[model samples]
Target: MSDALSEASDLSGDDSQDVMTPTELIAKLEEAWLNEKFSPELLKNKSEIVECVMEQLTHMEENLQRVRKGDVKASIHRMEIDRIRFVLSSYLRSRLQKIEKFFPHVLEKEKSRAEGDPSFLSPEEFAFAKEYMANTETYLKAVALRHMPPNLQTIDMLKAVPEPCLDSFVFLRVKERQENILVEPETDEQREYVVDLEEGSQHLMRYRTIAPLVASGAVQLI
Candidate 1:
């Protein structure tokens, strides 16, 4: 009886060492999620947010290994993992939708302005519009950075979008040209051709030059 009791005590000790507490697991998961969402500078410096996510995944894998080795309680670990995964996935999906919705209006405005006659806008006025568009892009990017997780799935999706598709704003250079206009007389006696010279033309002059408005947290897709 004494030997059996000693064996049972040893087994219990082993189990205790192997499993992580629920509180500890929850804390670690939350830390990983927050770091991924709120740290854009870190993500940029690192070059790939997916790498950071992989590191977190590796840590989780280690934890799983411990459970498999009978060091932790499988039921407890599974529960914690499931909870964290659900929260992260739901948050990311919602945030991506928000980002998509926010960019379209800004893009449309920039497109309209680019297509409009630049002669109507002074240099100062154009500059202000450009600055406003830039600021909107920056704001959107920052918001995205705060909500997205640096994960393989997200990164892959971002990479798939064409660069041009991502850039919704464009600037056009307008140039002045001379054209001839013909005037017809009501009486069939004579017809007159007159050349009307104007500083601005009805047609918009645009060059092939394209500028991409990249936002801070905007991920570049292929």
Candidate 2:
């Protein structure tokens, strides 16, 4: 039995060219769950699979960086990024399913509540959940992007913007006011001007401008 198991392991290790389809990978993982003797090796194989996925994610990230730097055209970079994102999303969905399987109680509870009482979560709870999920997703994206090469165009974009302007700009307040034709401009206003920005938009603007400025030592984030 030991010799047979050893031979099987060796065969698996040697078959590097055998590219596993996603379905095959999932089936292998499921098989690992059922067979106690195979579980350990299967777990190890899953890690290897995840590593392979990470490599692809890294390559995609490098391409995105190249686009950001202007080394690659925006359209091409975007397409590549989109492709990577799709594959990564698919893989993540599969991984999340496994996670759900492992934590069925927690996931089922959340899913049940989500299905049964659409309004089980208060507005605040919904907002919190959305923000939390968005933050987690962003973090994962950044991790994937870090593996990509830097974009050369980003440097040029950075060079185009003035250092002084970048440094002096401080985000103070944000407000939303409806356009009123009847309202006149205040000559001596007691109220300060408030700038309103959509969520995530400010961060996007900051990344485009502030990141480069900070890199050049022209701006600091408080």
Candidate 3:
């Protein structure tokens, strides 16, 4: 049950006390997957959950290697491994796409982070973003900027790629009741209002309005 958590200290790079049974670990990965898929911007990195899942996969795979091919138990183990691999690869690919699309913004956010604040990116993601940024700048300068006047040559990537549409509509389910959340108007003619998020209720609303709630685990993006 705790096999997945065996590498917690090694993967997390800290003596983390957090522990989860295999079921809990899988649930966390699924939850994280949903949140990442729905959010316009990259959410906080779920490195802990990812690390544990990876550990589980590795342990299961090693056991499978000891079994003969096509055994019943081996078949089931391989199926589970493939399923986990699918989710893990999808989750990482989604993040990498965002990093490529919004590298400037991602790096800026990491740069401005205060000391002791939890990182929005994992170490690998941060390095990827940095490399992506460098490559982009080089490409731009070589193909376009070199021909432009000096004054016009400088490119601000932050302005070039717009930030994620935080105010975009999103569908979510309330996990815990939240009171008096402000909802901005859809049009100038309409007035802003507030509403309570009843537990277990699902609604379509602006992401910005519930952004904090999503980060706090008060709601689940459908």
**Top-scoring candidate (lDDT):** 3
**Candidate 2, RMSD to the unseen true structure:** 24.8
Candidate 1 matches the true fold with a TM-score of 0.25
| Per-residue lDDT over 160-197 for candidate 1, one digit per residue giving the tens place of the 0 to 100 score | 32222322222222123334534334468877555443
* TM per candidate: 0.25, 0.24, 0.91
TM-score ranking, best first: 3, 1, 2
For candidate 2, what is the lDDT? 0.38
> How do the residues 126-190 of candidate 2 rate in per-residue lDDT, one tens digit apiece?
34445554564466457664565666212221233223222233331112222211222245664
Span of ten consecutive residues with least summed lDDT in model 3:
7-16
In model 2, which runs have C-alpha deviations exceeding 4 angstroms? 1-46, 63-74, 101-222
- How many clashes in each candidate? 7, 14, 0
Q: Show where candidate 1 strays beyond 4 Å.
A: 1-54, 62-72, 105-222
What lDDT does each candidate get? 0.38, 0.38, 0.87
Q: Model 3 shows how many backbone clashes? A: 0
Pairwise lDDT winner, candidates 2 and 3: 3
